[model samples]
Target: MEAIATQDRITSKAERLRILEQTLIGAGDKGVRPSEIARRLGVRRQTVYRDLRALSNAHVPLWNPGRGRWAVLQDQYVGTVRLTIHEAVALFFAARLLVRMADEFNPHAVSALEKLSLRFPEPVRTQARQAARQMEGSPRNREFVQALESLTLGWIERRKVRVLYRSAEGRAAHPYVLHPYFLEPIAPGLAAYVLGYEETYFRSIVTLKIERMTGARLLDERFEEPANFDPAAVLQNAWGIMGSPDPVTVRLRFTPDVTRRVKESHWHPSQHIEDTPDGGCILTLRVGHTLELVPWIRSWGRSCEVLEPAPLREQLGAEYRAAAALYHAG
Candidate 1:
């Protein structure tokens, strides 16, 4: 990539004098247009006129207008500037993402940026700072950030590390690392989840809860993997990031009063909806795994009915009865 032209590094007057002399000496190049120079160089029209006049003063035959056309008398281009608005925005975001992700690893650079004012123009600097501030606490998730940072580094280094993690059912274990592919932002905004292969399961990209991670490193040696390890394909179809091979086809019914509530939100991608004859709605959700969705399913109370997946229906019924038994035992 060619360097972007900026006033950041301006040439000496002596170098400018040499270029002007060369323009005067060269016959092919003539008449640097003020407007073209200003547009291409990213500066005011007056700045271009000033440079042209500076050249002309030194015996260079540079002209602003001649025969309704203007061209640069100089054969050499100092540089070029061609940053569109879209590119500028993208660069701004990329920088902020880097700063947020790399703050602890390179604290010196981050501190330097914060202490001294940005070298860019005031408006651009202000906008960038505002964008950074917007990301600072938008998630309100500072509790797991440090742990995430360490895990992220371990993933990049391809080393085994131990983590005291609480499972979905709240079981604790020291999960050893096999390999880390990537992290993903699961929710539209705020939340992030680390999806990586675990040594315990050998190549399964287990979905671990970032919030439940206890960043305690273990004394165990680094783990290894063979060349022929294959990751489970069932993860792609898993609902809510729970990868389970034994999936179920689930169906739900919404009463007339709660029909609008059921249709308003998208629970899953493959959800099917049908309008009922009694002005109600039938919501069918096919979950590849129904383990984590138990609480969510039961929250609907009498409004939702489990119409398929005999096992899930049985599980929910047992759970409901067990809860009722809590009061009976009391």
Candidate 2:
């Protein structure tokens, strides 16, 4: 009986260590407190501390961020990849772009940059590390991170997720069960959105901003993406991330002063340019909606004119008049 009890203790210790490691990894940058770890493992705080020490001695990159919280340095645990000099430089550039795009602190991005920097040489390595540090300085939005994680899990596993979402209009957050199909990053990359099927209320595919999700939880049930659903095709007519079922033809004339500037870049795949006799140009394209195009057209100021879509032209005219009124007021 004594030998059997000893064997049981050994088995329990082994199992506890395995569970402990998983908990630390899942904790990410937030880490877990020793007390929380103890509670989870049904052990004493001292025992938890001892286990953490044992794991550290075994070469796990465990990090402690005050208040007795412990976490795993995930970048250190992942496998290594060898990259050529040109590839490393390209990766470094991509990492910098990500840093510039993010508006909030994202630990995973920081970790990725740190890991990539380790493989780079000299000045490039230093630059990558600097970019990671800059990203670390951004404000931490814990709720946003949690929502993103839940949605990511659902999307990868084809599981349904319940999220409390609020729209840009500042409406009250409402719950919905969603079948996440794709995650898309808006151009210039300041924000990310998920396009999914709303199973509970809308019963339609909707695009939701990740930052607007107040809460999210993965459901037990799974789903399969629609056979005919193609994200790229769906968004092909989109001016930005939002797409419309019915596309409209848009025509814009750029003054000669800015026609050369516009012709320098291919704005859209559906665009066709026609040079006018007056040295100006008319660009035509079919887009889902003109809502997103409004801002871009406004950016060109007087150099641009909306020739087709009378409603859009009138809308911009009213906006311009309102702005003029503000400036012209005594």
Candidate 3:
């Protein structure tokens, strides 16, 4: 197939740079001719020669190996960035994380890394790439990625969106109209959620999981972000992603078995720990209603107990009874 018209392909300065880098790196020892570079760039051969000369003058390691052919020396690039080992390792892992979470790994990130590695100091690049591979995980399905991209566009354009979503309860998918405002990243996924106004429920701000959105489309209508909307303030006391509008002060007592572990980690922004007699500890948190905390408390089993909030305690009792009944039935 004929290559895309170079003018159509190189739409931006960044694209031109990427193409030049790719061509130079691909032409290892054989060295590419100026005419070939001109054909690829949709420019005249003279223009290519001028650019090459300018690059050489700028101390870019471009050299003519032989026979009117030009090539970039291996591991030598113009304006190559030098990153500390720690910085390189961090970026490598971050790229791997984005790749793992994206349906198709971001092409720009992959391309940038490839370009950087071409000039990175020998063994460090190899080591960082290896470590990154070990950090990679499976990406989401294609449809989920598409939905996420659509939602992101809506958020950026200040447009409303309609979404077909499947809940964690395994119920049939339902449609929702939302005014997407922000995207927040949660655990188990590298992608963030679309936090927005649920139009069906007026004045309610809800968090929508992008992965659960089976379908999404942006509406023509635009929205004004709420003047009082402050994401940080809204989520200041949240235990997890979703929290109650009216938070409660919760007190829980943990037995000595897990106090050390519990104290070592900062569970929430409002969490406070007080040492109790008999080597136990009391954990206090001013947080949203206790719906999301149930699983966390239950995970501790008999070692933990909710000391306050009668309603939450009652809910837990009911859940335990339901569990007992299910086990007894078998």
Candidate 4:
């Protein structure tokens, strides 16, 4: 009971300090009064004065300029970085998107923002708080979240992990020995992929969907992450997630209807678009394989045509034939 009471005292002291810092840091030139701090913290005004005196004695850079105003002096605030309301809001949203990926509300992140919001003045403070409450996060699988957390620990500690993963076809689960290196969050934060060294795949790196990872445990063994390991450099060779290190040159022709959309944002790092004589444009890319690119190619229907890379063209033809068979059969 004594230990519990002592812990409570420590927690209360920390909260008081946080409140004091937040109030002073955001107080600007007008400064804050003991009454305001006391009222906000539900403490007596004498307690606020005593706390301020203690803080000043501890070299906390608090100043009691003339009058009853207490302010955080500018000279003592030089070293630390301060975030503006806009930056704080942006960070809040970005963190919100990742919260779903973690499969739980991140209390630490929320608390940090809450403390930072204390530094925001007037309408901006209210706005930041409201935005934080209203922002929506993506849906994440609990099992996948657990796996990701464990794998992240292994990645940070440079330890190996055993993952029970199920393939897309819903096959039986298989245990994979992995040396986790990096996590890649897909654009718009829809999903994430984990890239690492799989013991079964020699001399090459492998990728796994975080959602497919049912279980992950850190092993006692440790491994060194390659100094030159870069996810972008490795992914640059392909259209989507996983691809070979070697880049392949691929070209395609797109009709005028969707030419602008195709040219607006780069589909691949190596993409180059050229206007054709007809009302169309030719797109070129140096990628690793056409397997992932096949589905996207088919999405364009007749608007897109594979030009270079004869194998991709043949594969597209086969896809078209199979698709046609499906429609004809029905």
Clashes per candidate (backbone, < 3 Å): 3, 0, 0, 0
Cα shift from native, residue 89, model 2 (Å): 3.3
Give the per-residue lDDT of model 4 (tens digit) for 27-103: 87678989889999999998898888876765568877657889887544532336776776666566555443444
Please give the range of 10 consecutive residues that has the lowest summed lDDT in model 3: 131-140
Q: How large an RMSD does model 4 have?
A: 11.8
The residue pairs in collision within model 1 are: 31-71, 32-71, 32-72
In candidate 2, stretches whose alpha carbon ends up further than 4 angstroms from where it belongs are 1-80
lDDT of 3 by residue, 1-330 (tens): 245565564465345555665687788978899888889998888767767766666566877789998888774453446688677767766655555555433333455666556545667577545534433333426676577667777888888888888877978988888898888766433445777898875558888788788768878989888988888887777776666668898999999988898989988888889999978899998887677678789989878888888888888878889999999998
Give the winner by lDDT: 2 or 4: 2
Candidate 2 lDDT by residue in tens digits, 1-330: 999999999999978988998899988988999999899888999999999998888677899866779999885674235799999998988887888888988888898899789899999999899999999999999988888888888988899999898888967999999999999877543898999999888999999899888778989999989999999998999878878779999999999999999999999888999999999999998999888899899999999999989999999899999999999995
RMSD of 3: 11.7
* Residue pairs in collision within model 2: none
lDDT of each: 0.59, 0.89, 0.74, 0.75
TM-score of each: 0.49, 0.73, 0.62, 0.62
Instruction: Name the TM-score of candidate 2.
Output: 0.73
Sort by lDDT, best first: what order?
A: 2, 4, 3, 1
Q: Candidate 3 regions off by >4 Å? A: 1-84, 88-140, 166-174, 188-192, 200-204, 318-330
